[model samples]
Target: MKYEGKIVLVTGARRGVGRLLAEHFLNQGAQVIGFSRHEDDEAQLPGYTPLAVDVGDPESVARGFEQVRKQFGRVDIVINNAAVLTSQYAMIMPAGAAKGMLDANILGTFLVSREAAKLMRKSKWGRIINIGSMAASLEPMGDSIYAATKAAIATLANVMAKEFAALNITCNTLGITAIETDMLGQLPKDKIDAVIAGLPLPRYATAEDIFNVVDFFASERSGYVTAQTVFLGGVN
Candidate 1:
């Protein structure tokens, strides 16, 4: 229970990788607050508090953190896992689709990280883990906008690492590729197969794979490891 007594906030906790991460933290004895646009009543997990908020909206993010402060006294860790991906070639990608990607994948990560840092500074120690994508470096087809957003997240995390260093807050990005989740289910079969074949591991990543890296970042032992993007799935 490395995170025992810590207060953790995870965005997009309703399902997929976010949900798995939240559960992992709770299992480690951390008080986990899940932020998503809607509540996951089906989860019904003990020790997990679900908060409804659109991370893309500044007002919504502010209110959500206010509630966290009021209820938890402080936030010790923040996992910016909320993001959206739409597969479309840049030439014909809809404007609204692009905007949605920007709003959730870009704006949402920024807003949540900004607010979480405020609460974390109170204790002079915290962990900020931003979920990133290999698409940023790989530049895979049908992922231009999504990759751009992930690139922004890595940049933001790097700056936050430097800015928050004095406060003992470490910021890092975990760029994952070909994760087996509902999000991946949206891609065409051929595309998914091709990605898997190219990966050195030659297999899709599981939620457990992501949890391993996140667990490291959330540990007190990882204080010196910041401003780095740790890519997974043997992509590089």
Candidate 2:
């Protein structure tokens, strides 16, 4: 119960990595709040609340935070896990697809982190962890927009680390490798296999692997750590 009494907010928590993260935090004794475009039955779980929040929209995000303030009074840790990915060659990528990726991956992280920092300031301690991707460093073919958005995630966290330092809030990025998620399932199996084969570990990452890193970043002992990006599978 290291996170006992902590209020954790996870974006895109309807499914996939976001949902897994919400569960993990709850098990650690946190009061978990999940933000998704739509809520689900899992919202009924003890210690977890799901809110409909489109992080890409400023107003929607603001309303979500308002609800959080009213219900939890504050946010202590935030995992910016909301993102949209499309793997397509730069030449053939649709404009709307690129824009959607930018909005969900980049703008979403920015808006959530900004609001999280504000709520955290009350207690003068917080953790903002952005879910990045190995694609950023790999720069895989046909992943121009997706990779760029991920790379931007790391950059955004780094800058926020400095900006939020005075508030005792640390910001960092966790660049995960391929995992069994609906999003990853959208990619070609052959492509994912090829990429994993080239990795130092050469295997699919597990939910435990992700949660381990998250725990480290959210640890009170890690207050001195900020502006860092840790990539799984030794990508960087």
Candidate 3:
């Protein structure tokens, strides 16, 4: 659909791919509401509103949506992108490390998607695009917690798609490979290279690469596609 008048909300929009998604919507003339844990950046783009919010907190997610409703009146599309990759090794994982991963990746998604659906239900039309990871499917060496959370998200999307289809709403997940984002900064160079070598494609995913799929989901043409996890690694 035309984004000219559509209201889009993107989580984790302070930087990385989430920021790019927000930017794409704004460029298309949509009113964008961006939720970030960080303070609003100085280099603000037009047609976008940045709100500091931690999606894992139900109160914060609710407050963020309240502001979006007040500012844009309603939301048509929601991109759940805020996630954590702090757990490097399952054996060394701290007391609450796994719980922390679930809080941000699973519970956070549940909270935000639930709120966004409320607004979309009003219009009887909505799109929910989850930002997932290939690690969820591949289960790489040290990503047990992260993988589990994303796996849960994928299932969540599947169920939401079934329930929301009657209301003309769509829910889906995009399981992406390694992208050169802040999330990747946590790993060492050799580890990163090992990851890059695993992908069928030579290059890592760019923010633009992920945004393309998100853009497709935001379109009227994608109304019939839901509950599917589109993996965007190079021909694997």
Candidate 4:
């Protein structure tokens, strides 16, 4: 139980990678708080607390953390996993769609990390893991906005690592390639196949693969591992 008695907050925890991470933390004896746009019944599981929040909204995020303070007192780990992937070429991307991605993917991550850091600073120990995408560096077609948003996240992690270092809090970005999730399902079969063909590995990454890296960052051993971007797909 590496995370025994720790408090972990996972955004987008209703499904996909976020849900898997929340469950894993709970199994490791950590108190898990889930922040999602909608309520999830699975959060009823022992040691899991669900918070309905729109991470893009400052008021909503503030309210969510307020509840966390009321119930848990502090946050030990924050997994900024809530994001939206919109595929469109730069020229054809809609203005509204671009703004939406910026709000949910960039601003959302910033808000959660900002609030969580306050709680973590009190304890002088915390791990901030920002989920990123290989598309940022890969420059895949039809993902200009999505890739840009992830690129911003990687940059944010780098700067935050330095800003929060004195408080003993570490920030790192985990950039993953294609994974089996709803985000992948949105892509055309041809596009998905092309991504797989480009990967050096035979299979795409899994929720467990992402979890393994996150678990490492959550441990005491990774106290010095900050300002780094770790890619899981073996592409780079």
Model 3, total clashes = 1
Model 2 TM = 0.99
Can you give the lDDT of residue 80 in candidate 2? 96
Candidate 4 similarity to native, TM-score: 0.97
Q: Which one is best on TM-score?
A: 2
lDDT of each: 0.90, 0.94, 0.85, 0.90
- The deviation in Å at residue 235 for candidate 1 is 2.2
* Model 4: per-residue Cα lDDT over 13-68, one tens digit each: 99878888899999989999999999786567988999999999999999999999
Per-residue alpha-carbon lDDT of candidate 1 for residues 29-81, written as tens digits (9 for 90 to 100): 88899999986787678788999999988999999989998998889999999
Model 4 C-alpha RMSD vs. true structure (Å) is 1.1
Which stretches of model 1 miss by more than 4 angstroms?
Answer: none
Q: What TM-score, over all chains together, does every model reach?
A: 0.97, 0.99, 0.94, 0.97
In order of TM-score, best first, we have 2, 1, 4, 3
Stretches > 4 Å off in candidate 3: none
Each prediction's total of clashing residue pairs, residues at least 3 apart in sequence or on different chains, is: 0, 0, 1, 0
Better of 1 and 2 by lDDT: 2
Question: Would you give me the overall lDDT of model 2?
Answer: 0.94
In model 4, state the lDDT of residue 187.
Answer: 89
Segments of candidate 4 deviating more than 4 angstroms? none
Best by lDDT: 2
lDDT of 2 by residue, 182-208 (tens): 999999999899999999999999999
